[model samples]
Target: MILTEEIKRIKSTEKEARKFGIQVGLVFMIITLILFISDKGNSHYFFIVGGVLIILGQLFPQLLIIPNKLWMSLGVVLGYFSSRIILFVLFYFILTPIGIAAKIFGKNFLEKKINIEKKSYWNIRNNHYNKSQTEKQF
Candidate 1:
């Protein structure tokens, strides 16, 4: 049977998840080793756990499915919140001050005008194009 695009995508995701699990397991093992070398009391317990994780990740990556799903879900949630906060900071702190400064300097980028006596709101522009400009066809 021919594999669908979604099936291919899911296979790739599973592969990546396996890699992520292995990497996390290695990191934990490294940290445990460091702690052990430092003569930390709880290092043995962490080392045992990290060794188990490394073995599981290497031999039975399927067992990491739940943990992988949970990690991905947490990343998605954190990314959503962090992106909103970053955008809010950029707009409020950076863009707002720039906009206020532009207004103070009488720089109307939007070309807004306040005139009570104006009959029409249309600001007509000269649409006349020269022969050389038309020939360019940009």
Candidate 2:
């Protein structure tokens, strides 16, 4: 998706980029401050979590640290199941082998079109149009 105008404006200008970072930092500071003003020690834990997320978002360490495309792709897939450890384990134990097999064997599988639903090619100038489906097979 294309960025909205406001985001594009920030992305286009170095000055705006600094301003954006500062404003985002201020937002984090405000949250931390509010947490601190109410209670001190709990907020410090929040600070650690917020800091890690911010740093990761700032520098996407995934592209550097992961090292392998397969492993990176695995991490990206596992990320969806991060919240549920059991599902992640199940996927690791069960579906991973199937996926590997698919990668190895399914590469040579013939492409077949099973579903065909015919519709008009276009709407003509007046009210009706001729319909045809020209299928090209590899």
Candidate 3:
């Protein structure tokens, strides 16, 4: 039973990978068409490669396994590095300058006040409420 389930999973994964390969081939073909339309040099190579990919993707998709794996690995590595760079840019270029400017201008967004002489940090407010105030708490 376990072997059967594993086989099914593997079959499904292969089917999905085949579909992905076909999609990638179609994209390459589309790029080739665009390049041809623009009359670019070396387009014949792209056309030949794209045609071969499409044919292989349709006939023997298993042959595309290595290329698919390499593409997925590249995407993973690029995604990790791109996300890190984007976050670094956001925090360092955007938020860091805003924080420094706020510090220089004496702007406290969190409303935190520090006093060494104060024993308690809590401030007590009046709790007396009328009936109308209780009815509309917001």
Candidate 4:
């Protein structure tokens, strides 16, 4: 089946999300390294920032790749609270898995949806053919 605009959009967004995710991970790693090397006893603030960055890294990609509008909306709402470590972790765990699942299955899912739409349209058009044939038979 020909790729629909929506499917093309999703594929492109998924690529961008992957790149952004990699950048986030790298930045988080760098910050962690800086915190370790500095070894300041009062570095709790740095740790907090590192933790938040880690969650944001995961959350950002998940938000871009998630196919479900409801989940995407929920991700946005949850993102506001991701500075809280617990909610950050929760969002990372929940949304990341769903986003991965969407990536894996997205092409097939969209192809099926498109095929179904095409079939329905053709079925409607073919109904006229069937009726004309039957009407002439009698």
Residue ranges of candidate 1 with Cα displaced over 4 Å: 1-14, 33-41, 109-138
Q: For model 2, state the Cα shift of residue 124 in Å.
A: 51
C-alpha local distance difference test of each model? 0.74, 0.52, 0.75, 0.55
lDDT of 4 by residue, 19-72 (tens): 555555566567667777888454556556556544554666555355333334
Model 2 Cα lDDT, one tens digit per residue, 1-138:
222332333222334333434444456767788999987667776566556545543555343232223333455556545747888777998888877897788653443434356364443587554444335333
Misplaced by over 4 Å in model 4 are: 1-12, 41-60, 64-138
Kindly report the root-mean-square deviation of model 4 from the true structure over all alpha carbons. Answer: 20.6
Give the TM-score comparing model 1 with the true structure, all chains together. 0.61
Instruction: Give the distance in Å from residue 130's predicted Cα in candidate 1 to where it truly belongs.
Output: 20
For residues 22-62, could you state the per-residue lDDT of candidate 1 as single tens digits?
A: 78878888888899888887877777777777777777788
Order of quality (TM-score): 3, 1, 2, 4
1 versus 3: better lDDT goes to:
3
User: Which pairs of residues collide in candidate 2?
Assistant: none
What is the model-wide C-alpha lDDT for candidate 4? 0.55
- C-alpha lDDT (0 to 100) for residue 35 of candidate 4: 70
Residue 75 C-alpha lDDT in model 2: 52
Q: For candidate 1, list the clashing residue pairs, or say none.
A: none
lDDT comparing candidate 3 with the true structure: 0.75
